[model samples]
Target: MVRASACGRPFVREGAVSAFPFDAVIFDMDGVIVDTEYYYLGETAAFAKELGLNLTQEELNGQVGTSHQFFLRMLVDWFERAGKGHLTGEEALIRWDEWAHKRPRDYQALINPGAVDTIRELPRRGVRVALASSSPMDSIEEVLNACGLSDAFEYVVSGEQFKESKPEPDIYLHALDLLGLPANRCCCVEDSVPGITAGKRAGLTVIAKREERFGFSQDAADKIIDQLPELLTLS
Candidate 1:
C-alpha cells in the first residue's frame, strides 16, 4: 500500500484482482466508525437531563445515523411543537457542541474498534472503498479526520449531497455513481435500519452490524455481523 498525497486518498499498490464477491464495499460512517451512536445517546441524554425530560432509548434510536440537517430538523421540530424551546437548528447544534466541550473528553476521540483496519484492508484487497454516510460532509470530515481515515476511501459521500438521506437509497446510489460500480458489484456495511434499507433498495448486499438501536428489524439485512473485523472475512 502506497500513500499518495492526492487529497490524502489511499492508493493500492498495483496488484492482482481479488476474488472478493463484491467489487466495492460501501461503509456507513457514524456508528460504524466513531461510535457516535453511543455518543449521541449520552449527549442527548445530557440534553434531556438539562431540560428535566427523560430520554428514552426509542427516541434516541430515531436520531441515530442521520444527517446533521436531518437531526437538526428533528430536534428543532420536536422542541417547537412541544412548546419547550424556540431554538434554531444552528443554535441547538451549538448547544450540543458546547455540551460536548464541557465534558471530560471530546466525543470524537471515542472511535469504533477495528474500523480503520477494516477500511484500510478493503482497498488493499482490491475492493473499492466508499463511505455513504447520512452525516453532513462537515461532520463526516471531522470524525474521519479524528479517526485518521479521511483519505482511506476512494469516495466519501454525504447524505446532504443527495436528494435524501438513508431509507431513500439516494445516498448509496450517489455513491455507486461516484464509484462507477453497479449495485450488484458493491456491498454496504451499515449499522442502522434506514441505512440497511437504503443499501438494499440500491440493490446492494447489505451487511448489518449487530445492534438494536432504532427498533431496526433484524430481518432487513442480508447478514448480521458482531464486529468490524468480520468484514475482512467476507468474500
Candidate 2:
C-alpha cells in the first residue's frame, strides 16, 4: 500500500480479488473532470470562422478528446481547400496559440460537482488515481488548480507529451506506465469517443460520462454514468 500525502489517503495493490477487477483509476480531464469542453469548442469554432471556415457544432463536438496539434493540422487542411494553401500547420498552430493565450480568464469554468470528493475517496479505498488528458500541461495545471484538484491525482500526464494522442492509446499507456500498474488492473474514465477508444485500446475498463455534449457511445465504453459520484460504486 502507498499513501498519498496531498489527500492523506492510501492506495493498495493487493493480489486479485473477486469483487473488483481494477486496482487503479485513470481520469481524463477536460469534460470529465471539468466543464471546459464548451470553452474549447467555442474557441476552436471562432478560430475556424476567422479563417473563413464554418464549423458545425456536431463537427466541433467530434473533435473532442483530440490533441491541439491534430485539430490545428485539420484546420490547416481546411484552409488549404479554401485556397489558403500557403498556410502550413505550424502557422495555424501559432495563430491558434496566440488566440488561446489571449483568451479571457472568465471563459474557463470550474465545474466538477463530485470530482473532489470522489478523488479523495478513491485513495482511501485502495485505488490509485491518475490524470491522462490530451490538454497541454499549462491548460491542465490551470484547470486542476482552478478546480482545487491539483493534489487529487498521483500522476499527471498530458497528451501533448506523447507523439500521438487519444484513439492511439499513447496517453493512457503512458499513464499506466507511470502508475506502475498493468492495463488489466486499471480502469479509465472518459467523456469523449476518442478518449473512450484510447482507454479501450489500452485494455482498461472504460467508464464513459454520458452527460457531456459529445463522446457518448455504448460501443466504446464498458459502462456509462451520468455523474461522477456514480463511480464510487464501481468496486
Candidate 3:
C-alpha cells in the first residue's frame, strides 16, 4: 500500500509500475524537454567574452544543467585560473547576468525531435510525468508554454526553489515528493551529467540521453538512448 503525504497527494500514479519498471517519470527541462542547451552554451560563451575572457566549449559544457550561482562561481574560478584574478566576483556576476538578459527573446531554442508527440503519448499509456529543472521558473514556463508542453506535466519543479541544485539529490527528491512515489518507483530522464547524478543520488532509475556535443558517460545511467523517442517504449 502506498502512503500519501500532503506534498504528494495531487499526483496520480498509474500503469503497471513497480520497482523494476518505475511508476512516475521525471524529466530535466533544458536538454530533455527542449533543446535549449545550445542557447545556454552560446549565452555563457558570449558572457565570458564580454568579460574579456575566452571560454572554450569544453569549459561551458561543464556548467550545463547547473544553477546560476554555481555557474557564476565556476566562472569566477575559471577567471582566476586564466590569470584574470583581478576580476572581482561582483563584476563577473554582473556581466554574466547582463549578457543572459540581453539574449534575444525570439530566438528559437532547439526543439528535440518527437518531443511533443512523446510527451502527449505518455498519459495515454498510463505513465505520470513531471519536469524537474535547474532553470528559473519564468524560463521553464516560457519554454514549456512556447513548445506546447505546458500541460503535459503534472508538476514542474524549479531548481531555483531549492538551496541545492544538480549533483545533489534535492531537486529529484523534491520531484518524487511532489509525485507521492517512492524513489524506486520513479524513473528520471536527463541529458547531462549533473542531472543524472541528482537522479541517481535520489535513488531513482535513471535514463541518460546521449548528447554528442557534451559527451556524457553511461556508467551512472540505468539505461541510455540517443533520443527522447526511446522513452515512449521504455514503460
Candidate 4:
C-alpha cells in the first residue's frame, strides 16, 4: 500500500484505505504515543541479562504490542524452558513487579516526538480522540500526567480493564462505544501488528506507526507512517 504524504501526494502501491470520514481517533500508547516500548524492552532485557537469560531481538519482538501481564508470563515461561531460571511462575511474577517498582519509567524522556501536538490538533480539526492502550491503568495515568496530556483525550481506556487485549478488538471496541462513534468514523493509531489487527477487526481504519524498535510488520494495517505528526495531514 502506498502511504500518502502530508501534502496529499500518493506513491506507487496497491493498498488504499477509505478517504477521511474519521470523526474520532483511537491511539495505542506505547510506541505510538509515549515511546515507552524501548524503556520496557531495555528494562526487561537488563533483568533477563542479570539472570543469564539474554533475549534475542526476535524474542523481544514477540513481547511487543501486548499487555505487560501477558508479556511477563511469556518471559517467565521462556526463562524456565531455556533452563535459565528455576523460579516458579509466581516467583517470576513477583520479581517482575519488584523490578517495575524499582525502575519507574522516565516519561519525559520517552514521550514520542510530535505526539502531543498531533493529539491536541485533532480536536481543532473537529475530531474527537480517545486512548486504547495495553498498559496497566497506573502506567497509563503516569504517561498521561507526565506527558501533560491528561486532559487532551476524551476517554482513556486500558486493556487491563478489558477481558482481552490487542488482537482481540475489545479495547478499541470499548473506546468506540465510549466515544459514541462507529468504527467507520474512527481511526486507530497503532505500532504493532496485534494492535493493527484489533483496530481492523473492530472495523476502524488502522494507521500503523512505523518504528524499528519492535522489528515487526505485516499487511494487517490500513495505513503506515514514519511518525506521529505525519498523521496531522489526515486530521
Q: What are the clashing pairs of model 2?
A: none
Q: What are the TM-scores, per candidate, against the unseen true structure?
A: 0.84, 0.83, 0.82, 0.83
What lDDT is reached at residue 52 by model 4?
A: 73
- Model 3 / residue 99 / CA error / Å: 2.8
Q: Which residue runs does candidate 2 get wrong by more than 4 Å?
A: 1-21, 78-85, 105-108
After TM-score superposition, the amount by which residue 161's alpha carbon in candidate 1 deviates from its true location, in angstroms, is 1.9
The models' CA-based lDDT, in order, is 0.75, 0.76, 0.75, 0.76
Model 2 lDDT tens row, 17-110: 2344577899998888887776777887887787788777778887777776687678788778667665777887776678778876552355
| Prediction 1 TM-score vs. true | 0.84
lDDT tens per residue, model 4, 60-140: 777778775587577678678668677665788777787679876789788888999988777676666778888877778
Q: TM-score rank, highest first?
A: 1, 2, 4, 3
**What's the C-alpha lDDT at position 158 in model 3?**
81
What count of clashes does model 4 give?
Answer: 1
Candidate 1 C-alpha lDDT tens digits along 100-167: 77775454577777888888787777778878778777767777777888667777777776656888
Global Cα lDDT for candidate 4:
0.76
Could you tell me how far off, in angstroms, the CA of residue 115 lies in candidate 3 after the best superposition? 0.9
Weakest lDDT window of 10 consecutive positions for candidate 4: 1-10
